[model samples]
Target: MKINPAHLGFDIDGVVADTGGAFIRIACEEYGISSLTLEDITSFDVVDCLDMDQGIIEAIFGRLLDDPLDAGLQPMQDAVSVLHSLAAKAPLTFVTARPHEEPIARWLEHFLQPDTFKSIRLIAMGVHDRKTSYIKNLGLKYFVDDRLQTCRKLAEAGITPLVYNQPWNKNGHDLPTVNNWQDIQALCAE
Candidate 1:
C-alpha cells in the first residue's frame, strides 16, 4: 500500500496490541497476584486498581517497556487484516505514547505482512498530551484510539476520534466507538 500520513492516525496500546492483557499477565504470573478481571481495570492506571505497590508497577512497566521478554504481544484479532486494508486505501499513521522506539516498531513489524503499507508511519510521542499534539500537528482528519481522554482531546480539536472499546474508558463517553476492526474499517471508510 502506498500509505500517506495526512488523513488517518492510530494509537497503539489498547487499540492495536493487547497491552492490557500483557500487563495482567505480568501481574498474575510474575507479580504473584492472580484473579484479576478486566472489569476491575476501571482506569488507565490499571495497576492502581490492582492495589499493587509502586515498585511492582514500575517493575512490570519496566519489563514491558524497556526490557520486554521475547513473549510476543498479541495483535487485535482483526487488526492485522483491517490495517492492511485501510493502509491500502487511506493514509495511515500510528502515533503512540510509548517513550521508546525499537520495541514498538518491532512489534508493528511483527504483524505487518509482506508488501503492505510501504509508507505506513509509526510515530512515538511519549507521554501526556504529546499524542494530541502530534495528531493536531499532522492535521489528521480521523484517528482511532482506546483512551477516552485522548479521544476527547482530539474531538475538541475538531478531529474525529473513533474510540476503540476497552474495559477502561468504555463508559460515560458518547463519542463514536467501535467494537472491532470491522467497525473501524467501516468508520474510517465513512
Candidate 2:
C-alpha cells in the first residue's frame, strides 16, 4: 500500500542511521574487540546480545549518543537519497529515542543537504517507549522504526507501524516491513 509522504515518519538510529554498524566498528577499531559483527547484534540492547563488558558497551553507546557525527555514524544505505526525495514531497519528520536533539541533529545536518535539513522536523524524545503520542501529535499515520517493541506499541495505539528490517527486530513481529530505502520509497505514492 502506498502512503503519503506527509503522513509518514521515521526513526533515526537503526532505521535511518547505521547505528549498529557504527557500534561494531567502534568496538573493533578503538576497543580492540574484533569479534563483533552486525549479525551478532541480535538484540536491540547490545549488552544483552554480545558477550562484552557492560562498561565498554555503555562507553561506546555513550559516545554515539553524545556525538554521532564524531562517532562516524553513517546513514543506512540509500537513506540520504530517499530522504531527499521524500523531503521534496513534504517536510521530513524523524522521531528518535535519543535524549538530546543537538547531537543527532548535527549528524543529520552533516549528511542531508542544507535545504533538506531545514525541512526536517526532528524530535528526540529520549525514551524508546511511549512514542505513539508524539507521532499522533505530528499527524503521522505511519511510522518506520527498527525496534519491535516501539512498533508494537504504535500498532496497539492504532497507528500503522512499518518495521524497518533489522537483525535485532527480525523476529517477534508480524507487521509490514521495509528492507531498505528503496522499499521505503516504493511505500510512498507518487
Candidate 3:
C-alpha cells in the first residue's frame, strides 16, 4: 500500500540514524571494547543483550544521546537521499525518544540541506511508550520505528507502524516492516 508523505512519520535513532552502528563503533574505538556487532545487539536495551558492563553501556548511550555529532553518529544508508525525495512531496516529520532535542536537531542540520532541515518537524519526546499519542497529535497515520514494543503500541492505537528492520527488533513482531530507505521510498508512491 502507498502512503502519502504527509501521513508518514519516522523515528530518529534506529530508523533514520544508524544508532546501533555508532554504538558498536564507539564500543570498538573509544572504549577498546571490540567483539560487538550489530547482530550482537539482539535486544533494544543493549544492557540486556550484550555482556558489557551496565556503566559502560549507559556511558556509550549517554554520549550518543547527549552529543550524537561528537559521537560521530551517521545516518542510515540512503536515508538522506530518500528523505530528501520524500520531503519534496511533503514536510518530513520525526518523533524520537531522545530527551534533549538540540543535539539531534544539530545533527539533522549537519546532514540535511538547510532548506530541507528547515522544513522538518522533529519531536524529541524523551520516552518510548508515549509516541502513539504524539504521533496521533501530529496527524500521522503511519510511523516507522525500530522498537517492536513501540510498533505494537502504535498498532494497538490504530496507527500503522512500519517496523524498521534492525538486529535488535528482528523476528520480534509481525507488523509491517521496511528493511531500508529504498523500501521506505517505495511506500511513498507519487
Candidate 4:
C-alpha cells in the first residue's frame, strides 16, 4: 500500500521498545509483590497487573524520576530496522500512554542513537484515552499498537490500526494484526 510517513502513528511500549519486562519488575519490587509472568499479567488492566492502586503506581513511577534510564529494555525484533526504513521515507510519531516525557526521552536516548530518535516527530505521552484523540487530531491515517482495547477503539474511531501482536492481547478477534516490526513494515509497505 505504500503509506506515506505522515499518515503513520506508533505506540511506544510494545511497538518500539519492550517496556513490559521492566514495568513488571519495577511493579513487583515497589509493591512488594511477586514477579508476574506475561501470561499472568496480560488480562489484567495496566494498574491491576502491578498489584497496586493508581496512586501507588504513580508514586513508584515518580521514584524512577532520578534515574529513568533502564538499560534493560531492548527494542523489539526488527523494530529499529523498520523504523529506520519508514523514517527515511516519511514522518513517524511515537504515541505512548506514558505521562512523562523526561523518562521516556532518557530511555529512548539510552537505547536509540541520536539519528534514530530524531526521526520521530513527537513522543506523545499521558493517559490512553487521550492517545486516540491525539492521533485523530493529527490526522494519522494508520496506527500500530499492542493493546487490544486500544486497537479496537482506534478502528471504531475510523483509523486503520495494525494491532501489534502480544501474548496479553492474543485472545482478540478484532483489527488487523502484526507479529513484529517486520510484519508491520510489510503492512505499511502494502
User: What are the per-residue Cα lDDT tens digits for candidate 4 across 21-53?
Assistant: 655667676666565666565652667554557
Tens-digit per-residue lDDT, 1-190, candidate 2: 8899999999999999999999999999999999888999999988789999999999999999999988899999999999999999999999999999999999999999999998899999989886899999999999999999999999999889999998999987789999999999998957
Worst 10 residues of 4 by lDDT: 63-72
lDDT value, residue 133 of candidate 4: 85
Q: Which pairs clash in model 4?
A: 1-190
Between candidates 1 and 4, name the one with more favorable TM-score: 1
Decoy 1 TM-score against native: 0.88
Off by over 4 Å in 1: 1-6, 67-69
For each candidate, the alpha-carbon lDDT, in order, equals: 0.77, 0.94, 0.94, 0.73
TM-scores across all candidates? 0.88, 0.98, 0.98, 0.78
Total backbone collisions, model 4: 1
Q: For model 3, which pairs clash?
A: none
- Looking at candidate 3, the ten consecutive residues that score lowest on lDDT are 165-174
Please list the residue runs of candidate 4 whose C-alpha ends up more than 4 Å from where it truly belongs after superposition.
Answer: 24-35, 44-68
lDDT of candidate 1 over 1-190, digit per residue (tens): 2123358788988888877788778888887779776677788876556677879877777777764435446778889988888777755688888898788777777688655545667787778486877888877877889888889998998988888888898889999887888887765563
Better of 3 and 4 by lDDT: 3
